[model samples]
Target: MMLSVIIKRTFVPGGFPIKYIDEIFKAIDLLNVDSKYVPREGQENLMLDIGEAMQGEAVLMAEAGVGIGKSFAYLIPGLIRSKRLKKPLIVSSSSIQLTEQLVGDIEAVSQILSTNFTYVVGKGRTNYLCYARYKSGNKHKDLTDILTLQEEWKTGFIKPMEKKKWCVDNCLFNQCEYRNSCDFYNMRQNLKPRYTSSVDCIIVNHNLLVEDLKKKVKLHQPGLIQEGHSIVLDEAHKFEDIVRDAFNIKINIKMVKRMERAIKDLEFDLGLNLKTMRLLTEFLEDFNRELIKIYAIEGKYILGNRLDIKELMSMKFKDMNLLLAKFNTMKSELRYLDFKDSKEKVYDELDEMIGTIIDYFESIGPEVSVYWAIYEKIFDVNGLALCSAPKEINKIIYELLFENQKSIILTSATLGGNVPINSAINQNRAYYEYQTQALGLPESTIYSTPQKSPYNYEENTLVYLPSMDIDVREDSMSNDIANEIIQLANIMDGRTLILFTSKKQMESVYGGMLLRKDTFTWKLLKQEDNGSVNRLREEFSSQKAVLLSTGAFWEGINIKGPELSCLIVVKLPYPVPDPVIKYKASTNPLVHEAEMMIKLKQGTGRLIRSEMDLGIIAILDHRIKAKKYILQSLPFRNVTEEISVVKGFVENKMAQYLSEQR
Candidate 1:
């Protein structure tokens, strides 16, 4: 039974009902009346494809290039589907910033389409302030100030309060006196099916979505997100890493100390002579000491091979089993004692935590998971942690998401790998092959041909690869890169962003620039030296200054106009050869280069943010020249190896910019 026949409507070639396509076209026409909206062919095509996928209950992987207006394209279809089906649509993104942006886009789209559907922004439990924790503590001054302002805050999500010790997970849930007024509790209630009929869309970060799936799939519980909902994963390139992190198990000193505290609290409350509890605490202390002996270094180290696991188990397993027996004995005693409900819950939670740790330890092996040990300082307090993460998350992703959801759409600007520019041979599948395999989507998953950005890259951007003969490993590399940056920044008058893969290298180059400060007229700013990333970006936008940064600045940054005319890449962002990378490399030797190409595309994307924007992207590392696939991955068409060409482009663009200002 074809969907078009079942619906008894004329259908488009892509399987979208003709009426739905007409409605989308009408909405776009209405939107185009606004001065800010430009009707893009690619955006319309993407919207139709997404609508077709939703109607067919299929998985879709779309690669929408930057400036293709991807947000509006997906939002139009997502909102229409939710309204038509009378079910909620879930949108998951990788970061808080992007989630917020999507919420704004959804609001704007709903107004234009006149759908008038309700939506809610969903974040993790920790993201919201637990009213019980707020009322229970003498807060730090910084926390106190934020809480004061939270009175007027509608979301109750103070960014600074995230990951703090006294929050939702640490608070009493329904038992708390503040339950009625609790923001976290109320938000949870809003997601229930009874309350969700009016809610057409739910926007959340990837972590919260994964947590919901885990609850539904593993715990036989109603999920935080309602079942049978279609999901749209924006920034889908980052989904794999987020899922891996969500599933990994860790046993840190803090966790053990919390268990000890719970035991002591229970003993006091129950007024029981729990000698075994005392011995359990002592055994935990001994276990920490043993871990410290093995993981003496203050850094991350991979724990490989079954022999290492056997040795650790031999030293600690006997004591752990003895404590487990004692804990079970204590649990039996608890059945006879009339304890408070809260105390009973705490005892059960502690039991589960300990049991999970034991199970995780038993499961440690190279074939199933990757084990690692970390000895680091948290808030100046030294702590040791043993962690285990799955070797691959593809199967889990498929089972939890693709298999269960009615429809799922994974879209990102860099979702696809290198597809040669202007190639016509199965470009759709070839472009998405890496991501489809990496994410474990079905073989029949629909892959949209990559949507091209409307921005004129050939006329507005230049790809500059300096002919400098310097390796990243050389001691003189920082100085040499600094010298090249000085020349380029001088030509652009310091509207430049110098991106580095290494903090040590960035600092060295910053130092070099300081020594030669008089050689250039622009003010120099380094990340963390002046202020936060946002503050530094704001300052750079307001002045002709060069900013040196790494990490977050590599992607999800938008700087338009003359303030950012040049971008300098210190080196290709190759994945650091950690245990995870090593494992991935063992399975696929080309994964490293593939990752580098994706990151290189992201970094270069920071340059031309709009049609009016003109910039030059300079790759200072000579290594990029060897990776021929990079040219195909990047968006720019104008390539040059000479500094003179960069100067010419900068001068012409500057002249054009000044004339436009006049």
Candidate 2:
């Protein structure tokens, strides 16, 4: 491995530490030669490029198709680099499932190497239950629920910061009452100094990385730029949109009401002073009333192009200070409470919630960001957010992410965005090109490549683009899509996934299907409508079911063989014209179009997870015929104008799989 990497690392200018990568992957026994051990042609190549990418001051953008051993292609290089350089290497992914898989795979690979490396799964602190806080506060029923990594609140016993070494806080571990029993704090105390500070790698989801970057920006710390540290983004394509979401500071009504409810409940149950809770509640109510009034007028409309942070700061000066002061006073009052008192935890959380709200209020003053308010009736959510829409993420990336870095590698199966966040049309013409530039790194610091999947798509897949006679431009489109899906599922014998652009539309289609439930032999499962994607995935993989989903179902799902045979694209994934999309499209239409293209690609990519799996993609939208860019990455083996032909293709694939099993 070392010899191969050294020979191929001519792309980047640096003395390659070829030995480290060899040490990391040498024990990975691919020679086991089992059903899953088929070595991909692009895997070794990706590893070589990653090795060069990790050698020194360089940025590499590589796209490897599914089943390309992408995780280790970068992981082995990153681990070796982190170990050799004695700097932290961050491997960030878009989803928690991927992050957890990397964490586990890193350990397995290290064991194979006959070596040990310290690594922590970096997530938002709120995902872990603060043991001290949990024991001290009211035992809310919500605490009993199992928490997925996506949750933001730091409460309950669910997933209690399992690694004690990574749980270090500012407190002296020995003096803290909960130290011995505190899973998170204790872990951090021992491991942070013993490991994390010197640890080789940190596995984190994109959200946490973005949040940390946002904090770093606000604090003005020299960001991710230690001498030896480097970075790798597994699903790098999602970074821009993830960053956009992270940078936005939203104050939703649901959160405000939750705060009020927390205060009121604790005040009654813990015997806390009613005076303080009342005061807080009154202020919150006033805030909610103002938001509701605005929402009543402009349902989901953006307030303005930009908010003057100076004006917001001055506008709420006295009220803001009073609220902060009150929370501070409440926090101080906890000192007088008994150490064992549960009321202490309640007030502590209350104070933190208040502080978080204040932080949002303060986020707007920055010149690089845009602030706006939006009112929407959906989920009854409405609030003010510090939005950095349609702007200079590339500048931030170059200045903050790349400075003082050794290597940066970005990879994703679908890297579809084209318009630059802040680039002019004269500078770059395509979204992907703009995306490559928007990272703002100097040309000298970057090296790039693309990889095609080893899959025989021409032999294994069919793409159906049938002309629809039904009028789909009207409100009845949802019903039309539902009927087509019903017909397709019956023809294919009930293994289909229908991807929708809007949840409302998905629900409407699902409802339409329900109206004639007896017409089909398969079960229909909708994302969120029937539990989460995890649950839906299990149900679908285990049985013959037609899964109707949007958003989350497009990617990060695998249903091999006969369990999944068809994918239906309800639309071309045009993002709902939300404030963020509206603002972005206004500046550059390509920005919005690129996002839709990326989503369309992701939706299409859901089919054929395995090289042996066969599936058909039925694109229902006629508009896709005009949007040729959506088909740029896809190579369809068969493109037909008939639904029955696609259905026959699917049925044949399923029968073939069954015969192979026999």
Candidate 3:
């Protein structure tokens, strides 16, 4: 089929004007005239696939490999659609960094295409400065500095101000004295469809997008982004987890303390000694005693069979009901009293908190939700929380996002991990099926052929698996991995990123390295030893260093050239068994292995970031040797099980890098 015919059929049948499709083609052709334009076949194919999905108003899942210019692929079609439809195109990503990067990419795309479009980046209420809180006698130095710098700032997103102390938690909305001047309020107002006729695109992180959907569902209000808009989910693999987190409800010790403080403040202001205050105090003491007994082992545990819901209702819900009745009585009393508006707002806030807790407990059941208790030490403070997340978030996602939108496009590089270059059928069909079931996409959802990365990974990258047979579950695995890292670090001249699945393992390996630090010429850095990850990355990037890190470093840290030449995988990135994973495993036994493949792909992708980049990856886990599927999922097939082969490969890459430096 001709490409133009495919474009026409895809868009015209679905109500898009043929002229707009023609314009898109012309704009794409214009790129050839520009000296900076490099024509990539993969990028063009993905762009057309997204365009078809948008015009057809269908759901699409696409996997575009690294360096495929995915942001441009989606943005080209998204911009055209928004312009023609005169409706905002909503683009969501997993991180604030990615969201900001998309904004920059959109600006560049607009310039390349010679099109003008207005867009706004939507963030959570907490990210922006709350004028109401600032004006309410907050004399904190950080707050003052942020306010002083407001003119220089574009979004008023001050990271230095403590969120809990200055965010819009207890906001007064229209009643606030600074509502007209509030940065958060003004930004939200500007995001509304009725007010934002000029805004062609709305960029937001996944959390804010889900929160907007929640607001529409629960509050019956127009969301931060317009409903039924064409949406693109960048880094779409993380969307399911983000939706689960946004919808999960929890009540922690801090919440209980806040309720206590609010009630006491109300009593002092209104001069009314209500019986609800005494009941709340009694409930707090009883709840603490019960938590102390239940949390004998400090971690998350399923609450139903282990700590029977019926028993929980008898102990906590009964008192909660009594407290609810007392609060209801207090609400009636406050209506009759001549209290200030702020005090009345406080009373309503407390009432809602108690009501939400009661509703959460009432809704807890095996079929509808997974209830769990969390007991963990955070920043040296032992905390307890009762939480519940909807077990079938697939249904929630379908109803809230997929069912109502004009079109939905989900795209990522590691969507199913290194789909084969040119298979007649998608070799990763089972993986895509798993994602569809997990995300609740329609049966007819379109799946784009995975666009392979154009980089020369075959010559530039090697996957090294050590022949050692140390079990990762055993205590000795950390030392074994540390020894392997020591050898690889010396071979690569200390340009290594050692990744771990467990923080404890990382610390143990760091300790092992510290003992032999005197022998190495380059600096050895641990993630926690540095004040922050950014600082650690800065030092690692600017000098010859070996970094020991876990978590966020596995992905999203991009360093081209010799600064990050070798990557080490200490273990496969398997998810720890938590309440959520436990429930998922009950339904799909391969959930753990599936998660590890995606993360393993991400970690391996950290090396060979660009075509000029040359590096080697070492997988220290012996378990990967047993799983042939995992090795197949990675980008490069230059595999070796011998340590000597790894040393030789690293030496060649180091030589190439030094030659280029001259």
**TM-score for all models, in order of appearance:** 0.85, 0.75, 0.86
**Once all C-alphas are superposed, what RMSD does model 3 give against the true structure?**
4.7
Q: Write the per-residue lDDT of candidate 2 for residues 386-405, one digit (tens) a residue.
A: 33342566666665566645
Best by TM-score: 3
Let me know the TM-score candidate 2 reaches against the reference structure. Answer: 0.75
Question: Highest lDDT, which number?
Answer: 1
| Candidate 3: residue pairs that collide | none
Which lDDT tens digits does candidate 1 get at residues 390-410?
A: 877888898888777758899
lDDT of 2 at 184: 52
Note the Cα lDDT for every prediction shown. Answer: 0.73, 0.63, 0.73
lDDT minimum window of 10 residues, candidate 2? 156-165
Residue-level lDDT tens digits of model 3 in 1-662: 44653455445358676666666577667754667767676787888888878877888899888888888888888898888888878888886667788888888878888888779877776566566666564555554665664542343233332443566666677777777867777777777777666788888888788998988877877775564478999988898888887877876656766767776766633344334555555554565566556554533332221232335555565566666666666655555555467687777777777665655655564467776655443211125456678888898988778767758999888777532223354454544655777788887688888888878888888888887777766657667777788888888878899998877678788888888887688789887621445547778988888998887788887888888988998888898776687788788666777777778878888887777898889888888887777787777879998878877776665586844531
> Of models 1 and 2, which has the larger TM-score?
1
Model 2: residues with Cα > 4 Å off, grouped in runs: 1-11, 17-36, 111-118, 130-183, 190-193, 211-225, 252-368, 372-391, 417-431, 437-442, 445-447, 469-473, 658-662
